[model samples]
Target: MNGKRGMHYVGWKTLCKTKASGGLNFHSAVSRSGPLKARLSWRFLQNKDSLLYQVISAKYGNNLWDATNRRGSSIVSKILLEGAQ
Candidate 1:
């Protein structure tokens, strides 16, 4: 569809609009929700890694070698497995 004419179709117009209207984009008035979601997801991943590190150290002691890289690798592997599905 052409740039200006893309929104002409009721279906196309609705798809380019907001989630409340069944589109992928968030409401224009509260667009910060998208950025907020990214920030929160980043923070949650960091928190998960931190928590995993703490648990590994507490259970396995300082011998939990290469903890940060290992944790990241595990997450990557898990994602890869899921993606393969």
Candidate 2:
């Protein structure tokens, strides 16, 4: 568990032990794997999509952050839209 935005509090997969870990690796881990500090740092931008993300289609861009994080994934996932709400 890490303490990035409260990752230690939220949850993380176990890793590097007698048991296999589900720890996030930069190459494959989801953008949500950002540390709490990163999350908090980038959080202010959540509601408004950044020009770059909007232009390039960043997956963690503002709209996704707001719709996904603001309402929680279950609601977002259930929405079933090609674009996030």
Candidate 3:
């Protein structure tokens, strides 16, 4: 036999689902980054006194809680703020 595989039996969306949903636990980049962005947002909200928060605040010149519509905020700051919302 040539051992050539035929058409896929399962769709890509089904294959990419979590194992708990009856598929292999594979994470797409967008799916994986969501939780990471949420964690960063949570950290930024909870740890205002931390050095990382202080550094980001110093550079961005906006409080994490009230960072909306800032002029010079970094892209990372904006993304985290959006995720927080």
Candidate 4:
């Protein structure tokens, strides 16, 4: 900012480490997405009767949970199944 380029003194992943580990303690969005997707996948498994689950299943078919058949799935379906795998 301020017409200046930021210095690359350390990698972003390193800077995201915990403060106790000598980093800035910032959370990376890339690192956070895995757990979030996994949580959503877990919720989908636990709440099969939910409307979202029902809609997704109806659209994607029962093979939705099948790891090898992700032919033309939507982004949401892909994310959920990826976390499952």
Candidate 5:
């Protein structure tokens, strides 16, 4: 809809902003996914005794905070660490 012929009345960034900020209140994919990823990371951090967490910890070790060496870390672990940060 950024095309000239289309109804490109507002910019994408503006359209993605919240109505409280004087925009349409639509959420961009990045903004929406960010919170969900963060929530997943938080859950992983808080639910250490959970089965899923235990499995992950067993595979990757329980050192979630020290990700300096990500050589053998799983993709999910990396994503959770980055999202938490």
Candidate 6:
């Protein structure tokens, strides 16, 4: 033997299924992030004293919720803005 072990790579769809369905029960990036981003946006709205909220407010202005002017926001900020809506 050349010391090579036989193994098969799992497909993404298989990996993303529930363990009961014979998969690893993993979540894809988009599946995991949408709700999490929305949750973060909600936290920003509800918790003004948090450091994240303070920083976002300062950088994006106090009216970060304004949808009309997202001219130069970062990807994260854009995600937060979309999640808020």
Name the Cα RMSD for model 4: 4.1
Model 3 over residues 1-85: C-alpha lDDT tens digits?
Answer: 4659666588767878898898887667777777788888888779889887888878766555566666776778777876776
lDDT of each: 0.49, 0.38, 0.76, 0.84, 0.79, 0.80
Q: What's model 1's overall lDDT?
A: 0.49
What does candidate 5's lDDT look like per residue over 11-50, in tens digits?
8889877888878977688767777879988898899788
Please rank every candidate by TM-score, starting with the best: 6, 4, 5, 3, 1, 2
Which candidate leads in TM-score? Answer: 6
lDDT of prediction 2: 0.38
The alpha-carbon deviation from the true structure for residue 32 of candidate 4, after best TM-score superposition, in angstroms, is 1.5
Q: Give model 6's TM-score versus the native structure.
A: 0.72
Task: For candidate 1, give the lDDT of residue 37.
Answer: 51
lDDT of 1 by residue, 1-85 (tens): 4476544445555666777767876345344644655554455346756764455446546443333445554543333233323
Which stretch of 10 consecutive residues in model 2 shows the poorest summed lDDT? 76-85
Q: Which stretches of model 3 miss by more than 4 angstroms?
A: 1-24, 63-72
Cα-based lDDT at residue 39, candidate 2: 51
- The top-ranked prediction according to lDDT is 4
Writing each residue's lDDT as its tens digit, candidate 6 over 1-85 gives 5658777788999999999999998889987787888898898789999998778778878667673476777776787887877
RMSD of each: 11.2, 15.0, 4.4, 4.1, 4.8, 2.7
Per-prediction TM-score, please?
0.24, 0.18, 0.53, 0.64, 0.56, 0.72
Report the poorest 10 consecutive residues by lDDT, candidate 5. 1-10
In terms of TM-score, which candidate is stronger, 4 or 6? Answer: 6
Model 1 regions lying over 4 Å from their true place: 1-29, 49-85
In model 1, the worst 10-residue window by lDDT is 76-85
Candidate 1 is scored at a TM of 0.24
Candidate 1 residue pairs that clash? none
Q: What TM-score does structure 3 among the candidates reach?
A: 0.53
